[model samples]
Target: MAGRLRVVGVRVERVSGRVAVVVSLGYDGAVVTGRADRATGETQTIQVAAEAVLEAIRQVAPGQTRWGLEQVAIQPMLGGPAVVAHILLEAEGTSEHLIGSALGRSGPLEEAAAEAVLDAVERRLGWFTKN
Candidate 1:
């Protein structure tokens, strides 16, 4: 185990005439992925990435811990631009907001978006590992 879930792969494909982004996250033994389709005229680039990562997280999360991707965007900042992800965590009648970011130039934007999502949930999901 690498002590946390890592982005195993991120890629885009065309499915049924729609563009889809697939994000895969995994530990050592098992891998899970989620996919989101982009509709025509969609403007937000990272929305599909966020949604795909959220779906992937849900597949491995414990019961009753709901994760929501409120917003995701790429913004310019000091030391180069970055992709930011806003996450909402709801569990046990409590809710917490978390934010994570990754440098946009470090990798492909779709891949960076997935990594940012993992950053947002890393602490919460770190304790759970593959058996």
Candidate 2:
């Protein structure tokens, strides 16, 4: 079996009052990066990070499935906040589906954002073992 794709890093920054997130993933010896933008608001960093991770995954595995984010929730953690993301993924040809969720936390907002995305990607990839 092929090795799984895993999120390696995430970077979040504020630009013109908006949030910009970049997500990096590693599979085998290849590295891929995905970017996303979001307006400043509650949990904006987390949202942008998640979107970037999803986008990167799509780029790496275009035929996997179409994904829709269902929910994102944040709770207090020891360092800062813990983000929980729920996503719905639908198969391309059939009606097969899967729900994936992940958790991330960090003292820094940007790192936390990236960690959340990494967690989500790990969980989502578990549903599709082929890639």
Candidate 3:
């Protein structure tokens, strides 16, 4: 594990009533990409984005504690729509819940979703991404 990872890119696509999200995370010049897809729905975009972030983390840094996305949504806030993410952290006989949010800012909803998930774990990612 290294330090905290940052969202570098997010790509979202909708085709044939299916939604796909890819989240790219950067750490120490290494970029990892995670992907998720589900049938399109009201909140499926955020759901896939959140799941993709967790997938990317697992790809580069395995054998760590557990990280599970509980919920994700984009709702009106801060004068605009904001993506909110709720996550469950499980580690060594302990568990904690974390919440994070980021404004949509007229960007791709997936971008906000990625940032929201990262924000949720910002403070506690020292070990999770430590190099």
Task: Compare the candidates by TM-score and give the number of the best one.
Answer: 3
Model 1 C-alpha lDDT per residue in residues 1-131, reported as the tens digit of each score: 45468888988876565668888888767899898888645745577888899999888887678899899999887866788999999987999998998887856788878888888988876543322
Error of 2 at 36 (Å): 0.5
Q: Which ten residues in a row have the lowest lDDT in candidate 3?
A: 122-131
lDDT of each: 0.81, 0.65, 0.84
Candidate 2 lDDT over residue span 1-131, tens digit each: 16666667777778787888888978888888988887787456667777787787777554757766655667676655666666667775654333333434435554554455556556556556555
Those runs of model 3 whose alpha carbons end farther than 4 Å from true positions after fitting are 1-3, 129-131
Q: In model 2, what lDDT does residue 87 have?
A: 63
TM-score versus the correct structure, for each prediction: 0.85, 0.72, 0.87
Q: Tell me how candidate 2 scores on lDDT.
A: 0.65
Q: Cα miss at 31, model 3 (Å)? A: 0.2
Residues 1-131, candidate 3: write the lDDT tens digits: 44568999988889998988888999878899999888886557789989999888777653657889999987998668999999998877899999999998988778888999889876777655553
Query: For model 2, how many clashes?
Result: 0
